[model samples]
Target chain A: MHSDLVASVRRFNRTVTQRVGALDDEYMARGRPLAQARLLWEIGPDGAEVAAVRARLGLDSGYLSRLLRNLENDGLVTVGPDDQLGGDGRVRVAALTESGRAEWTELDKRSDELAWSILEPLTAQRRQRLTSAMAEVERLLVASMVVIEPCSPNDPRARACLRAYARDVARRFDDGFDPALSTPVRDEQLIPPAGVFLLATLNSEPVGCGAVKLHPGTPAEIKRVWVADTVRGLGVGRRMLGELEEYAAERGWTAIRLDTNRNLTEAIAMYRSAGYREIERYNTEHYAHHWFEKRLRPPRTSGSRGHSDN
Target chain B: MHSDLVASVRRFNRTVTQRVGALDDEYMARGRPLAQARLLWEIGPDGAEVAAVRARLGLDSGYLSRLLRNLENDGLVTVGPDDQLGGDGRVRVAALTESGRAEWTELDKRSDELAWSILEPLTAQRRQRLTSAMAEVERLLVASMVVIEPCSPNDPRARACLRAYARDVARRFDDGFDPALSTPVRDEQLIPPAGVFLLATLNSEPVGCGAVKLHPGTPAEIKRVWVADTVRGLGVGRRMLGELEEYAAERGWTAIRLDTNRNLTEAIAMYRSAGYREIERYNTEHYAHHWFEKRLRPPRTSGSRGHSDN
Candidate 1:
């Protein structure tokens, strides 16, 4: 027989999907399909990129293009030059016409009604469960669906997650981070052979990244490890780390080391959990306001590779 | 400079870890080192195999042997007999001695104290945040870490998560679930090539899994998606589906669909948000549950992908 989980999960998916509205075809469909309506609302006062539109809606780009096309065909929106937003030739912009804006507002109200309709049936507690569960499901799904591809050191998503992480660090640290003062280990040093970069993807979107440097002698220095705001609780950071550690361990590195400003509580816990013991200060990486080290146990027979520690 | 989020996470972790006594050398020491304590605990009133202990801890066989030796050396536990649980030679077992029972009780008390200390801090709101965040972190971590390595089907973690998912549905359902009557697709069909199963993990622990089975000639079916109670809000089910859908897409399948009983409200909402739509009844496999479908978009380009309708 098949396992019991499939049935149970199917059951939960069914129950939740129903309560979450598995049946409503007419949600944003008062007069327009849901995606088109969403796109109309998303188009800015000036204009929006096909990419920006896609990002906001979290839709497949092709699917997004189709929705934009439908709205364009409806004479409610225009998709033409990206020049107004100063984009080069490759980027096309989509903007709502006056009529499109009016339609969008009306559709927006309808969307609200749709949300309310689904919300009306459940109790406050159920609503909380539904919302929280939906959110959690969304977050986790996004987290797992994200593949940690090895990207260039300067990849935009990787940089973006790092900047967010840095901005967050600057905000939290007693001495605000000066990218110059805080960014540690030379950038060139982080490039391959010495170290590698990893981009964390959720739903295939890059939301986080980490980096590690393998010096000729010292412990592998973990750096640039950060998770995106959208994926804070999805454990991307930890996975990135374990990957880095395993990668280091595979290389026969006897120890792994990382430092954080004292503010980072979770990183410390994570390191501790992975058999890392807190040793005294070890590195001079400028951004490393706090130093912690752990003796890496030998790798399992399962040889593995890939990483980012930041 | 360190990120505030990192700082908070670190602080939170420190607060919790200390409260939980997670890093104390004697934390699990229980009158013995952790290795010995673990052996004593594992060797219950009924004996267990040396192999099982190694497998459960992912310990090196030598490491386990050493641990067993320590326990034996202490005269608190013994591994004298290889009582086979099953037919395999790998099934050797270990049993606790009289002193081992007393030691286990002390360890149990310490563990309880640790749990309570970790729980006792802060107001209800913080506890809620901690548990919720822990749940969130746990789910995300579990979902990310879940190894989708092939198993012959009845893998216990998969089964446990599924059963938990089902029990939840049965409780939530207007009419309780009838596992025997409700399954639309049976177990053997969930095997690979035709179907894929995903298990969600946190801290290397499995918390959720979902499977999508190609229904022989019909459109593929989405079956059994369950998240552990510990990770329920971490958005695991959604991730499972996203990964499943992507996998299905790769298999050259189009128009993936699923069925659920009317009671599964959350699942329905997830489907709707992810862009699945309702159609007239499509299949009645054995369960013949309520059904839904979504048109598959084109094959993904190499660029990052976005989220789902469900």
Candidate 2:
């Protein structure tokens, strides 16, 4: 919260808001305002559940319905019960009409052109720098929004996060991973006293998960550390590691360990940098190439001091 | 632009606009609209001529008057002819009252707080990354807005840019730079047939300048290659170099050379990367530590093919 930091951020806000014409009544040369344009975009190519759109945008249900009604009146979109359209029939969904699709395409094209305009004045080299910096900023911003919360292992979103993580590792591992083959933690085991599951969510949608198993006489074992690729490099992996360590320490465990395949270089690096020392294989995990262990102090009661660099 | 590049920029635009609340009906809890707030900011501490304010914001005179009138009615500002207030009555000027200054300070503080809110959610590491990325984005965006145009070296803005450049180099260089001591290019020398001056402007404000001296038999010598710190990393230096080379080539000068002080590490690096080859010292100037020359190909005539990146 330094003044210099605040100044830089404010300057960034001023420049970008002006550059993107966000303050203009019209957006991207489109006749409609930005909110409508954004809604049309959220409807997207495949459409979306109306409730999901409302949730994603954090809009009130009444406000969202009014906006949808405006789009409908303009003949650009339609809202109907999902079940009536071969969906669940209960949840409402929004979809663009033919004209809406065309309008959205035009908007999309112009949005690209606007982006091009921002890039066009620079040489090829600077363009690359700007784009890469943008990618970095986007990643960090998304990471900032991800909230890590303890969730029941059996909770639907938490389960979904775990299933996605397993699917990703299965695709990436040399010998495809199978939950059946790996050491299994039942829902009961992931509950308090045995273990706890942590879910990382971005705007309320779970994007990553990690879990830790407590042992009475042995070191706690951290497991299932995974982050969505979209949020990688935002330090989510390290944050989750720190959180799980605190979770273990809260249960009076002083040592922790985790195993990973050699192919997962980034995760290995994260673990190494987070104060975990490489240890000789202590388990019979078939695909494990590296094992790491870290000694933890009793949990710090002062919340402000626990966030050591990872 | 590549679709990926465009998509990245658009995504950046979306996230920043949302985070900055640029689309909100109110800004920073300010009661007035953004335009009025912006005008208040532009009026600044010392106040500004009404015409200058209008020109700076690119606002129509009528619209500017309306906004000023609104501020006046709110008892936040006062407008009066220059002669009536102080000296010349021809131009009208606007200045904030005591209440206006207090309100402006409050708005400024709230602006900083809003910026802080964006950073507060992030951990220390991510905050650093976000701030650094924001600085890069700001640099590039400013660079993208700069338009380089051939201007008379004697033009007021052109000379202003050159003066600013000289002042900067004077502060940066060891012995300090003096236009009187450096190889002098008379105003006549910088005019066409002998040389050409290129002015780099962002929103009509001169931010940088460069000049090339063409000789009948020897390679053209580029001088005063400078970009304001505000627009430095956007590659304005490189673009200016390329443009100067093209300007020289158009007049049939096939090679170009420039000299720089050792303290100017970034300029030297840019020269090296832009295909300038180091040579034995070619200038008698006291501060020149490195001299670079580059053989230029005939300028590409096709406009469509030249902008390969964006």
Candidate 3:
């Protein structure tokens, strides 16, 4: 919100874009647009499902199809039905041709060179400092890029996050977690009116999720707050917590609570740091080791109720 | 350099480039490549010398000319010799036409929108965190991007740094600095065989300078160790100090010394932190209030003497 911050971001955008040669038409001098080059790289030697490439690149179907056509016309790629899994005719795959593989290799080498070019001018010490700072910036930028919004609990991305969350807890818990042994949460309970499921995504791929159950007459209960290892410690979990809390507060819940296993030490620390206090066990979930609660203030009059379409 | 650091930087490059839409042919959907839009933005409504724009963008003459020609062809800009300063026919300027100004305004608006788009998804608190991280990344990246290499003191860029250094000290010295009353460093003394002058540049523009004079027997004396205000606190001064020391050490000098005005507190602090020790007055320069000396380590056998063509 600060103008100075906005101005700083604009300056950063300019400097970074230029440094990375993002403005170049022929990326890495490969004689093709960057988008096409990136697509070729994404398809790779082993090839990729058309839908998978589209998802990873966040490219719309039409634009991606056009780029694929361009590469196909150049004799650098071939699009055909994926035959690896019994040839699902509706599911197409994009594979690099011999020339495309060569081009991809060249792009790979050039990418390393570009990275080195940025470091080469700097002294070894400055290079270290630059990279360290770069890592910090990348982590935080990723944190900012993550979008947390309401979603159907049964949506594929939401389901993916839930499966990841369960798998993660299974690995970390003292007694490995079992969904059958633990209290179950139905999709209907997480849908709007009764409650909501919040999905966190980066570039359209789900990385984290949290949900709240707005039980009648009782305080709203938070559940399944989880962040993927890839985005952990960048405060994705904290942001999810804040969003969940905001959601409950806006809908008139005065407090929220969640239970966690003792093995999830970092989650406990995060909860405490986020103003959630140690509380008596509020539920008899089989894996619960610690329970925490945070009182939420009533949403301001200016704050709108219902979901944010982030 | 750590491989992890390099890997992290590479990842940052990929993520940031995609987020900024740097790969788009039509930046901000303006129907022009990003390079052209950036050049148009650089030229501004008032116009700029063709040479200045090239320098700022670090674009080669051929590439810059082509971009200018494209804008010229589009009827958005005009390239002609300057007439306002008594018409130097050889000195060309690029000015926006009426339509070009309108396009510039649109580009400016889109730039703001682009900046906002990165922020709009987040809570205000996260926005603050993101912008703060961006500023840090920008500062460190700028520091890393700076290339310090030996240059002739008489070169225009070096001269510019010297002028800026003098102007800066003049404003800071308690009694004000007067070059006439101080020890004069001849250009030849700082141009090798005698010594070396190191110029620090961000992109192609000079931002800082340091020079060392290898006297016949005494310690090599450092002079005009200055960093522009824009890059002062990002460790440019420290890097310059290290480079100057390395230059002297590689050529058989075992120690270095410099005189400084007390009012230049940050420089004094940097020198102290960089292992410089207070010493007895070594010279009678009029405005100097502190004298410092640093013993230099011998350059390793693997280290080459003379200069690095950075």
Candidate 4:
């Protein structure tokens, strides 16, 4: 960790926050603190589930509730049971009143204006350069934001990634993907002793996943590596692969291998770059066009988390 | 401008604001609001002029005074006259008290921690990539933030830029620069109708300057085109050049030219790229090694601010 890198990041954080009007007492001159204004904007005209809004904003329950209460007192919003959904009565939802909807529209317009203000000062060429660099920074920051940790395959988030993965492959594969034709992966097999499933999430919303199965007498078998389109090309998939490899390597497996379809060119490239090499057929999975394997080093210490020094 | 470019910028603003903890009520869990904490941190142990602090933070006078009062009430700071410095009694300065200095140190530690937190999740390679991208974004954003507008040559900000420009040339020129040996520019000549002086500022601090003397019967002459080291190579010089040329052209001058020391290699390169071609000696400035000229396009409309369509 170079101190200069940290210093550069700190400088960026300061400059960006000031540039974005994050310090404004009344954002866009809307007569509300930035946090409250952002909350109102997030709630939107269509309303939102209380828990979902809280999670999206990463706000504590008490803080979120207070913000909601302020809007409620101002007659701009209402927080009540989500009875209209015909589901959980105890679950709350926040909806905008007529005035609130108008305010949200104004905020939307102001948001556009704010974006324009940053661009307005630069010439066309500089504008393009600024936005291009901004996109790169945003992509990399998002990649850093993604948290990959062991998750039960049965978890809804993990299931969602798997479903997405299947849909993606089906759309791209020549013969179309069919889980029925593939080797069955039992949920229990992905649990602790047998294997581990690593789910990659940004703000707790699953965006990618990978799994490794540690069979007693074989090299660990990697499977289901996938990254959501929103995070593609930002190295999320590569991070998932590394984490899956580490999971097996730390648990005493010496190597890991995965099969992939020819249509998955990017994944194959990533594997090759990550030190995986072509190998003889490791499995007869219906969709696999190539098999690749990599030998993993033993964990530096038992139960040690690899790459913690970073 | 592309709509996708604007969308990308908007996305960057949102993600960066959230990632930097800008929306937090108590930044770094300091109990004070973010604005207050930032103000305290900016004041520092050495103290600062109230006006300077307000300008740096882009805060309105009333709002700044309110923040100052709050800090005073909390016994974290003191706002008083500058009599100790033998300055104006009405001019106030804000200085941190013992507890405020301690709090500022805490905030500094927390800021480093926040930067580290962003890096901690990433692999060493990804960390490097992220920091590199962040530096790019920061540089470009600073470039975009620079606002160039016609200012009185006598203005303090403009004078500051001229002083910096002199110091910079003094160090770089082969024979060393002396203002007395150079062709003199008068304040009235760089004022409206005679000519124009453009000062480039970032958050009210001048970082660059350029001037064009629209002489009645000859080509417009450019002078003192310089950018501070802090913002060099970010296109501030180019923008200033463009703006100066536009100023001359809009006022009916068909061409602009300037003499530069050979040692100013980057400026010479920029001149060439900006359509300036080397010409025979234009004047007998003691240190000038090259002279360059460019034809300016007529303004699209009478009194039109060129490039506003962007």
- Candidate of highest TM-score: 4
Off by over 4 Å in 2: A1-11, A20-27, A60-75, A78-86, A150-155, A165-197, A211-225, A244-310, B1-7, B20-27, B30-131, B150-198, B209-310
Alpha-carbon DockQ of candidate 4: 0.51
Candidate number that wins on lDDT, 1 or 2: 2
Interface root-mean-square deviation (Å) of every model: 15.4, 2.0, 3.4, 2.0
Estimate, for each residue in A1-310, the C-alpha lDDT of model 1 and write its tens digit.
Answer: 2122223333333232222232233454566666665567668556788887677566887888788778888888888877655558888888788888788677655544444443333334443444454444343333444567677777777777777877888887778888776545566777777877878875456788888888867888888788777767666677788788766777767777878777777777777776777677785656555677777777777555533232
The prediction achieving the highest DockQ against the true structure is 4
User: Superposing all C-alpha atoms, what RMSD in Å does each candidate have to the true structure?
Assistant: 23.3, 7.1, 5.9, 5.1
lDDT of every predicted structure (CA atoms): 0.63, 0.83, 0.83, 0.85
Runs in model 1 lying further than 4 Å from the true structure: A1-7, A15-24, A31-47, A54-70, A83-86, A123-125, A179-184, A203-205, A286-289, A299-310, B1-310
**lDDT measured at residue B20 in model 3 versus the true structure, 0 to 100:** 73
As a TM-score, model 3 comes out at 0.73
Each candidate's TM vs. the true structure? 0.45, 0.68, 0.73, 0.80
Interface quality of candidate 3 as DockQ? 0.34
lDDT of 3 by residue, A193-254 (tens): 99999999988889999999999898889999889888887778888898899889988899
Q: What TM-score does chain B of candidate 1 reach?
A: 0.66
| Candidate 4 Cα outliers beyond 4 Å, as residue runs | A21-40, A43-51, A58-109, A169-183, A214-221, A248-296, A301-310, B21-27, B44-51, B59-106, B168-183, B214-220, B249-298, B302-310
Candidates 1 and 4 compared by lDDT, better number = 4
Report the lDDT tens digits of candidate 4 across residue range A246-279.
Answer: 7888777788898999988888999999999999
Q: What DockQ class does candidate 2 belong to? A: acceptable
The positional error of residue B249 in candidate 4, measured at the CA in angstroms, is 4.2
Clash count (model 4, backbone only): 0
